[model samples]
Target: MSFGLEVMVRSALSHIGDLIAVSLGISLSLNNLLTFYADRPRAILAAHKKFMLARVAELSLLAAFALLYQQYDSLYINTIIDTAAAQFDAGVPLHWQAQVAACLIALAALIKCAQLPFHGWLIQVVESPTPVSSLLHAGVINLGGYLLLLFTPVVAQSSIAIWLLLLVAGLSTLASALIMTTRISVKVRLAWSTCAQMGLMLLEFALGLYELVLLHLLAHSFYKAYSFLNSGNAVNDAIRLRLSSAAKTSFQQAQTSNTVVPNAQTWLMAFSISLAVVIAIRSLFGFDGAFSAWWLFALALTVLIVQWRTCEHSPSIIYTIIMGGFLCVIYAALKQAMHYVLPSYSTLTVQAFSLADIWAMILFSLLFVLSAFLHYQVRWRAVRRLSIALFAGLYLDEWLTRLVLKFWPVTLPARTKQQHHAKSTHQPSLKP
Candidate 1:
């Protein structure tokens, strides 16, 4: 329904349906919040409160777009485009007010999508019922990307808006992906992973890969839905798999060796293999397009292929190569199909990787390498401290919870003294 509304808004050049669609999107988010309220899990009440506040911010920013519509005296989004085009023709930049409106809209998208700083709410939304979590993660929250895609003409005109989306979304992707690895609980990890994936989706929109965004949006929706529905069975399945593997290994000598951590030399080899594969694909598939989306996809595939070779229980080289080739071919084919099937409502323009973008990618690469090193190497004091911080989500959410509570006190359900006493008395002894 949201997608249908978005399609209508995009197709209707003169209707005020954009505002209506955005309003409906917000309503859906509010519904999710209301569902959370009904369940009201005591453990996550504070998190739910923060989530509500973030939604309020999101709602406000989305509502603010109405001001722009009124200012132009036309309910049509074409007004924004025609005005900007006129300004561009006249060798004039967009008005400051227009830029401000664009930034506000982008910020709203960031909040809706649960990017960093505002990200605490999203990671903590695990308190919601699994169905709500599935709906929020899979369906509702994705409207942010749609919003950006819908308003690309106005939003992309402002350099401030562009940089804001890029930095915030990119950093959020990096931070959330890193933080997700340190989490232990299955649901919490899934929540963090959602945050990371949202960040990545937003980042892709900022890069003007709308087709890729659509593909990701569809794929993630199905995957997240299945994951959340089957979440309860995850532990059971893991245990069963472990037992089965143990049974199979009992008759043979067990290999209980420590995992071999890939050293610098191994990393170099992997890098070389990845590069060669990328070059081979480019040469064979005539993917020598602009140094943009294809290159990134190739690099990602290269990394996966390397991991397939090095990771525990690694697949055979022949199988890995075949899988990599299949993935590359399928992705390229799908991207090409989407190019024809999905029409763009606005001109897609993202400046090729700026220094900031490059630096961010480099930083993420370094963090990933260090994390892998720490995971396998002897746990030094520094590694331990880093791991602790990551495990605690860098205390980022905790701090946000504190600040939010300071301003908006959440009234948690009061526990009886007897309940507290019972909890205290029931603390399990560690003695074996």
Candidate 2:
């Protein structure tokens, strides 16, 4: 859910370096495959095509905004935002043009972030080199959040746009998360995770958890960079671990653990811990003057509690409490630091908390709870069927891929045996 907070600090911390870094990051990422054309030409082309589509979406959005501002009295972004807010406060309904413009911005961000139908290209990105993947997952994909953060002052006024962004981003997060589990290939799974992470970040932004979104943006970037770079070794480590286990037991392969779903006792314990922690935090911190973000906080606490309860090695209860306390403190401190560094431009108005916000919170909470239930019920027939659907990517991406191919078919000719033989044996005559 969205929150309303009085801006205790109103520093505009915009820096040229931030903009330059983001621009360069995006530029480098889009062209990261340039050096790999000889090795992965087809992959590069596919990614390039996807990038072009995203570029078009962004360009169109900017064009719309430019035309919009031309008709308005102010050219400054903040000034325009202030005027829109004042008008909205005065009971003036948002113009149809503005609503459309906001929707366009959301659409562009959705494409850039690789949400839903736009995600087919990201999956194919495994064909690219590792460095490219690192650059993409670490830097480029994060720009979608940056885009939303940048325009919140204006975009927040459009309820339609906010709802659209919430629904699309929320659905993308759910679908990608489920699909990720069905993938066996490491890179594909990582790509799916990236998509889901990006979607969740956008959803966080929509829910007015800007601080959490910023934290997520930075943390996920570093994590994904390391994950991609070390991905090759992960398979070896898994094999080695399996071999060591086999050596200590029967030669026949041991079944994978089915204890991912916590038993009822564990669930009760986790929920109790989570509730206690929430109550303690609320009593101590007084909701940080924003009770609207409570549900998200509660959800995080629940996830942490579950992680603590389901650990293979039993951790001391006191240690778990201390760790949770440390995490809470660190999160609060980091959120404060982010406010100073990336100061938001918008004021928290009542409209920020809309029906869309409630629906988004409900959807995400349901997804998390459903995920826990499904994990525990892995052996159920219905669960298996759902897994199959998820494995097929809910047939969403498959249909979109076909549509994309039909509209923009790959025309590059393949190097057949005859073509390779001719190229090898009948080289061009040497120039004099």
Candidate 3:
């Protein structure tokens, strides 16, 4: 390679810079070409070989990039590359310098994941089956958080840079999330959740507390995946949607011999497990007094399980609305609690990963095993639900945050409806 070509290629291939341009280009092209050749579903399934082969080509280029870019050569290749290294390497104590480099490297990897060109290949990706969307959302696109988590050890050491990255990403993601409308399939929403969560993870990196972020990522991923997969094609779950809980109760009353299908023992077990989780989380955080969020979460989960088991026996419309409402409430309450109590922190490797913290890896392994087992059931509709839901949750979270910041300007008097109500309530007190 000529010096200029070598410099350009090497800069593009940095550990942090990795294989984005090529992978994105390939993903975009195959996605577009296959879509043109076939209808949405057929193209997705039939073109898997081609799509995967394209991914292989991209990844192979990345591997080559990794090998070639190991030189750290100072041809002053690109301003962006130099700036990133300088920022990562600057003013840190020598002992912690490597740690900072590691974090910058991690940050670069994450940006690559979330920072694709927004040219709209995402739309086609969602048109595949619900399960695929959910898997892509909660599993693949979602990898950014874990990548950030993996590098938290090095990132936490860099005080100013990490915070700046967090703020910029949060603002950008919040803005982008708001612009995304309901025109896209539900899977896009899940993908956006990956964007939003990755932003939050960046914030955690900046904040220097990786444990909570790690915990959050792990828990978040599985639950999100499960939910997206389950809820993706709920439009077609016939018997469950028609009957309401009240109707079921009435039926039980009318027909004494009703089998009650759920196997009460299983219900009881689930409830106990749910309750224990509530108490454990509450104890860990001391939020809402002792058992506050626990009560809300438990109640919602209970209703959800009951609704799920009885959904086949009920009406789709009622079941869906009720289930959706409960889920929203659950999500809102959890976010609120986290905002109030948790200090966002990064889990930099030196901080989060010790020889002792090998346990996290072990725990992750177990989670993977459990996920495999759960996925063995593999209903197409279920996967679709999980995918769409994760994205929607992410999109909604970012959108609402943006809306408040933009219109309400919480610092201003009339920024929020709650603030307006507060002022109104105090006006009477002041007058009296």
TM-scores of all models?
Answer: 0.82, 0.79, 0.39
Candidate 1, TM-score vs. the true structure? 0.82
lDDT by residue (tens digit), candidate 1, 139-228: 877877766766666776778887787788887877787788788777788778887888777766666666777778788889888888
If ranked by lDDT, best first, what sequence of candidates would result?
2, 1, 3
Model 1 off-target regions past 4 Å?
1-52, 55-63, 78-92, 245-255, 279-299, 311-320, 344-348, 351-353, 416-421, 424-432
TM-score of 3: 0.39
Residue 51 Cα positional deviation in candidate 2, in Å, after optimal superposition: 3.8
How accurate locally is residue 140 in candidate 3, as Cα lDDT from 0 to 100?
A: 52
Question: Per-residue lDDT tens digits of candidate 3, residues 87-194?
Answer: 445643323434345444444544434432221333345555566555555555544454444333334455544544545554534433433432253556565555
Q: Candidate order by TM-score, highest to lowest?
A: 1, 2, 3
Candidate achieving the largest TM-score? 1
RMSD of 1: 4.6
Per-residue CA lDDT of model 2 for 84-188, tens digit only, reads: 667766767777777777777778788888999788878877777787888888888887777677666556667777777788998898889878988998888
lDDT of 2 at 295: 56
